[model samples]
Target chain A: MKNLLKHHETYVLLVIIIFSAIITVINPRFLTLENFFDVVKSYSFIGILAVGVTFVLISGGIDISFTAVATVAQYVMAVMIIRYGGNIFTAFLLAAAVGISLGLINATLIYFFNIPTIITTIATLNIYYGILIVISGGKWIYALPGWFRAFADIRLFTLCTDEGIKYGLSIITSIWILVVIIAWVILRYTKLGRGIYAMGGSMNAARRAGFNIFRTQMFVYSFTGLMAGLAGLVQALLVQTVAPNSIVGKELDVIAAVVLGGASLAGGVGTLFGTILGVTLIAIMSNGMTLMRVSSFWYNVFIGLIIILSVAFSAYQRRTKAKRAIAVEVE
Target chain B: MRSRHSELIILGCITTAIFALMWVFNPNQFLRIGNLQNMAFQLPELGLLSLAMMVTMLTGGINLSIIATANLSGIVTALILTAMINPDAPPPGSGGIIILAICAGLLTAMLIGLLNGILVAVIDVSPILATLGMMILVNGLTIVITKGYVISGLPNAVRFIGNGVVLGIPMGTIIFALCAGIMALILNLTVLGFNIYMVGSNPTASNFAGVNNTAVLIKTYIISGLYAGIAAMIMISRFNSAKAGYGESYLLVTILASVLGGTSAAGGFGKVSGLVMSLIILQIASSGFNLLGVSAFLTIAFWGFIIILVMVVNFISAKVLERKAA
Candidate 1:
């Protein structure tokens, strides 16, 4: 029972992969480069945010305002690059600054006022969306300079593979990969990462253990915000335009991917690799549905069902394990 | 007397300041009586939603899908009205079907809330996940049932309920106030409300103290669902239309009202009276901006900024509590 509880994420991953493989064999298009690339391109930015936000989730905090934060970052970048005549480097930095500041705002509220993360995030979420509207004045900014869009040109920049990034390896995809690797290293090797997990397991206990939880929380919120900023930048650059309302309902998809990827809403358990797999699983589903020409109407239904089933089963398996352990102890 | 006076002062200070600003700025030009009526008309769903938010939150959980349920309820009402009214067949504006359509919506919303409660309380899914799951499912169900279309042709009686006013007060505002009063009454005067607070404050401890945690949690869900239904009815009546997408944003606003009003998102503490004030505060803030006559786009940020300011106030108040506790 203990083993299963510990390794349920692994099992979920295995099952999903096998399912994907089976689907691939049945429909060769799923294996084709075009479909796979499409999946990568579509899911990369969301995948990046999921990987970052997983840190906050595992630390027993939720950041529901990330979509708003991302939108703000996108707007800042658009305004900087086009209206202000700023270089791409300056634009990206400005965007990142906006995100980090947002994260800091959230952290300060939860830590100082002892306000709940949910409430704080909800407020900030609106604030960011507000920024989006106020900045654009309810209009789309379409004429992004050429230099800004150049960021999307390198699919993989002639990486070790022949498939160019636009066909597969876009800058956003590469940067997301880099983030995953960096996060993995931090989680596996750094004391700060351990502090994150410890805080999630039990903040009181973590504090008793002498971990600086306030500091850790601040760092987590900030890190996630920075990543959200990066995501917004990529999204802005890719489309060569910014729409204030583009990501209105996308937060759910990102959260679903995080959960499906084997992270717990309860905190203290999840991996970058697991989240990546989770993002892929969702991306695959989205891709497959598109390939099948399913109505957008059904996409939400299927996705929603998948999210509920995955989480529900995980919860059920947990109770079953507790029952078995009690029986074992009795024996 | 001092505390009561202070709360009254705070409420008056906040609301009156907003009113002074709007009035000083000469709001009646673009903020016409019609727009004011429209705003009042919109408040029922938001008000009912805020009440539901207060109850669930009093139990220390959030139902992120209230809007979805409300949306679904709206769909059901539309469907029910259509089936009864027959837009093509007769002198199609018969009004008797109005009450029936709204009843169906409320019942459906209540059922959905019951399901939400069962999942969260019994199945042990966190309320966030459970309600979120319901949100996604309900949203899609709304689309599917409506076939991704707006279901209009509301019974004139129902449409009258949405459009009609009594003594210069829109039906939506009247309904909103009525629901708010009911929720406040139940929470303050009822045994069920007491149990909900006890259970939410500490589940294991509450159970040890003989409070039934599962029952309490389940009841909150029921209340939450009923509020959604009420909100759904108001929305259909006011718009004279029920789109699958119409009620999507109310969930956020109502929840904001609850949390901003001094209900701890952590549960175990809430005041519907405070929520009422908070709703008024939000309405005033939006109304003030509308009065200012700037781009309505700033409206969202304006709301967000107000919520953030409310939290700032909440945080300071918590510090005061901590000092007193010490």
Candidate 2:
């Protein structure tokens, strides 16, 4: 068991340590308070989404459509804040609605046809992206309303001398920090959360034990959708321009992060804390790589190599567990 | 048995409705030689990718690398043609120059396909994971070779193949039709095709019955790769220059065509002919929208609509079939 846990999240931690040591030696700007704040805010969007996806994945259900759902949220919000006189609050709600709707569509397809979760989500990914394309007519919407900018205002922990409070954390950063904490708490110390672990381990066993698979799947998918919606809003603030194509193929990174963070792509394993660490590690790699001006040429290759190795290691761990289980049964 | 055909009937109905929409809205523009030609050239990649998808789906695997493979081949062919064929001066016959380029591009893609097949079939990796790795690798390879630049300057012959038809018929249309025809024949008529279908639909049962599942899988990947190469040749010749993002937009559309055309993602039951038809239908829907001057960004939404409609139709058909069975 200890061996398994070590293998699960060990890669993410090693990456974090390796990058931290390298970046610190290479440049100290990586450890600065200001840069750290920016990283927190930027990663919160991905971090939160990863948390929800972790839950769904652990339950052995995959949701590839979240990126599409998030795209829908962004498109709607882009149109609303720009055209329909929608405020940040209203836009957020609408984004969430769009997310939940897409999620429901995925759940419906899976249940109605007994389709595999991966296939269902794959089909819906196109559906969501396709819908976005149709609605936007391949146009980009910029110039969101001013109130939408207020979402970025959450500031905390200023780094300033007695003379001037020049470097303080933003409200957005604080909110992201708070949300990550809350997510960790709800996932680790809650009964329903434990149910997720139970369910992901074995669907048939969970069902035979009278677990409500539909409700769990519906909730998990909707929750992931909501996270995607929230991520969309954060994305809007971070980039300050609504890019329809900005995050099209980002789910791969998210899945990579979750898997890197010690969450199993095979399900029934993962933790909130590990996910945050994984997200932070990726952030550092991307941010530091950019800061160092690593050859734009080798950057993707480097990152892709790490991601492949990390996931391959995760699969190896799962296989060991499977073999062990079989051995136990034989015994 | 009737329930099984529910997806087919719905797909047929939707296809007919699209045909009607084109005829009703702007029959002149919709039913034009030029438009038909546009679709014929435009759909080969989608058709080829769908076949690739069918292989993976049959084996309970999915390859997300189809576009990457296609794009990689396109760029490589373009690069070779421009650099090798006419490095110093303009050649009198560009057609011959391009033919050599096409051969190189298709061969390279097939080589990549061979890699994908080995990774999935021999390594025992999940099809999704195996192809995902290949996708990143190919995309990287493309970026590495091209440095993310568009390649122009193909032999005239190649360009002619893309733009010209066999005496009033565009070569693109003929090539695409020939591909579909060949695929349909091989899939329905040959034992190799039967083995592929068998492996994809029920690996365990097929294994017990002595089917060589790994060999079947490897063949499918190679075939898909070869198709990607062929599709790239068509695309490059048509454009006269290999664009930077040629095959990126094709994966989803191809997968959609396969599903919407009534190939079960579950595997054993799919028809290449149906997939080919569905590719044409997709082309028509998008082209029809483009003609209407609708914001093409909503192409995603349109596809979403198609998928949902396909699903709902499939759902209703299944229900009706069940009722009839009852």
Taking every candidate in turn, the Cα RMSD to the unseen true structure, in Å, is 3.7, 3.6
The models' CA-based lDDT, in order, is: 0.78, 0.73
Residue-wise C-alpha lDDT for candidate 1, range A80-151, written one tens digit per residue: 777678776898798899989988988988898776777788777877787667756768888888777676
Q: Which candidate number has the best DockQ? A: 1
lDDT of 2 by residue, B74-107 (tens): 9978887878676446667765666777788888
After superposition, candidate 1 runs with Cα above 4 Å error = A1-5, A18-22, A83-88, A157-168, A323-331, B1-9, B27-39, B87-97, B321-326
| Poorest stretch of ten by lDDT in candidate 2 chain A | A322-331
- What's the CA error at residue B107 for candidate 1, in Å? 2.2
Clashing pairs in 1: A155-A165, A155-A166, A155-A169, A155-A170, A156-A165, A165-A168, A165-A169, B60-B267, B162-B237
The iRMS of the candidates, in order, is 1.6, 3.0
The complex in candidate 1 yields a DockQ of: 0.60
